[model samples]
Target: MAWDDKRVETWVGIMLRTGVMIAAAIVLIGGVLYLSGRGPSPRNNYRHFQGEPAQYTSLSGVVHNVNLHEPRSLIMLGLLILIATPVARVGMCIAGFLLERDRMYVVVSTAVLVILLYSLFFHK
Candidate 1:
């Protein structure tokens, strides 16, 4: 089972497409919910970025809102998925490199994944 560059490229493309499609679907659902008067009401206080609550901005907050079927949280989750597409692509690249026995690329992809993770989860 030889995993060549072309095969890896195809796999990455498929992964990106799938991730984007799923994210789009989730966003669409959230939009529908919002337009149907199911989400939170609009805010007029535009003084200090009084947008969503603190729970909706953080990861655990998003998850909690999602569990409560909050439309905005679903939309946020979709955006998160969209943001994660490239990260997943990089992960697939690492897997492909490992399958092809390409140590150099595996290390490089791993570093990229680490940086992405750091920026997404750890960086302020």
Candidate 2:
């Protein structure tokens, strides 16, 4: 397939829109699940700066909770997917550049992808 700037823009727009929509749906469902019951907040301390639960703090923890259909985990998963959308766009850019025989952009996109992956997987 011949890639052009217009095609790149269209691809990026579609990716971003789809990612946001899916994430929004997940978050909305999770929010519904979380708010449907569980009664009122303890002591009505809505202003308190309580941190997130330990289960939502790590990748494995989130996955474990998600297996149990935990609402917060589902919400966090949506946020993670939202965050990953741009990374996926960068990957697509790399492929597009390769297809277009644009060596410089291919290299640049690869570097950016590597940096994103490093930050996501190892920088923590």
Each candidate's number of clashing pairs is 0, 0
Candidate 2: residue pairs that collide: none
Instruction: Give the per-residue lDDT of model 1 (tens digit) for 1-124.
Output: 6899999999899989999999999999987886676446675567886567786667667766684256777888898889889999999999999999999999999999999999887889
**Model 2 TM-score, 2 decimals:** 0.85
Distance from true location, Cα of 75 in model 2, Å: 0.6
What lDDT score is found at residue 107 in candidate 2? Answer: 97
Per-candidate alpha-carbon RMSD to the true structure: 2.7, 2.3
lDDT for predicted candidate 2 compared with the true structure? 0.83
lDDT of 2 by residue, 1-124 (tens): 6788679868888998999999999988888887765557664466878877798777667766784346777889888889889999999999888878999999999999999999887786
Q: Each model's TM-score? A: 0.85, 0.85
- Cα deviation in Å at residue 13, candidate 1? 0.4
Off by over 4 Å in 2: 42-51
lDDT of 1: 0.85
